[model samples]
Target: MGAAVAAQAKQGGAEVLWCPEGRSTETRKRAIAAGFSEVSDIAEMARRCDVIMAICPPANAESVAGLVSAEGFRGIYVDANAVSPATMASIKAFAFRDADLLVDGSVVGSPPSTSKTTRLYLSGSGEAVAVVAGLFSGTAVDARILNGGIGKASALKLSYSSYQKASRVLAAVAHGLARDWGVQDELIDIAGGRSTSYLAEPTYIPKVAARAWRWAPEMREAAAAVGELGFPDELAEATAAVMERWAEAKDQSLGISEALELLRTDGPQTAPGPSAE
Candidate 1:
């Protein structure tokens, strides 16, 4: 995702800089391919760039904010990670002593490549938000300014992803149950006849599994968001658990049926009760 954004921004005449301090070889290769200059130091990149965009997993958002803050960066800081509103607020407080320096941002949809498929929703002081939006003006990234202040954009993102990821998990679980009941074929046939397809596709499990590890933290963040809004968070918690179960197969990309078989055979098992009670 970072590579995609960097590539687009660079293509649009922006000088993209990336810190390759602790990143993997593959990550470094991608960043270089995306036309990003390696800064080799976070503080240097922070000092050089006018606006610092933090696009990372929800779990690392706070740490990234701290890293930038420690560098004495007082420039425009955009937090585009999938985190709860409260977390966003904490990051804003941690990174920028002045609230005006933080532009709360959320990226919805896939990474921008050759097409304008991603929308970056930003909310904060109007001037700061506008400045951040201007950075991606000619790029493939579509930056939109939200009316609400900091945390609103993050709230919208978490709310949207909660349903998106949870529904995918629900579809997978439904297929698993049908397969266990010996009616998988019938379920698919029924789904085919419906307006909205009910059957999970062959690629569904594999596609989701490949990113399940990343989704786990997002799911946890979504759970926290829902809980804060006085909603039952068990659904999101269960979805996170399911994603964690498939984390081992993230790179395997097994088919839906194969993934289900693996889950039934070698995944987490229920404890046995006393024999016949």
Candidate 2:
């Protein structure tokens, strides 16, 4: 997603810079293909760019911000990770430590591309949010500046992802259960009769399986937020546990039934293919 954002910026005629230090060779190749000017390190990027965005896993949000802060990257810092509002507040504390403006941002939908674009929800200093929004103007990234302060964007991201992802998992489990009773087709037909139903899209189960590793952590983050708000977190926690059953499916392709089998048994039935994540 970080690469997708940079590629979208470059497409929008913005001069984008990326630091390949500590990143994978595949990451470097993707950045190179996006036409991002490479710098030696984060310090170099901090010295050169007006804005720095971190679009990583939810677990790494704060550590990544600490790295940027240590380098004194006082430019507009956009933390676009999927974290809870409280986690975002902790990040805000350190991010503001260096007197740097922190813009809470979140990415919803898939990675932006010509075929499909994604939404970037932004919050924090109104001016800073506008500046970050302008970075992706007219690009594949739909930068939407919200009328809120730091953490609202992340809150919205978590709320949406929690339900959307859990529903996909629920669909897989429901279908698998129905199949055991010789009623899988009836289940699909029931869902297909609805205007919008995830159960009608069993083909997406394999894709969900491929992304479960990243998603399980996200659900836990959502559970944290729910617990913080004094609500029952069993739904999120249960979804995460189910996703963990398919943790070995990270970036691995498998058939719909095979993906569901992973949810039922500890050992997954593999259909060898290339990684997707």
**Which one wins on TM-score?**
2
* Distance from true location, Cα of 17 in model 1, Å: 0.5
Q: For each candidate, how many residue pairs have backbone atoms clashing (under 3 Å)?
A: 0, 0
Off by over 4 Å in 2: 98-100, 197-277
lDDT of 1 by residue, 166-209 (tens): 77765665566566668889988987886743233446667777
Q: List the pairs of residues colliding in candidate 2.
A: none
Tens-digit lDDT string for candidate 2 (121-206): 98888778888888888988999987658778888999888878877765665555566668889988888887965656889999
Worst 10 residues of 1 by lDDT: 268-277
Instruction: Report every candidate's CA lDDT.
Output: 0.79, 0.82
- Model 2: weakest 10-residue lDDT segment is 268-277
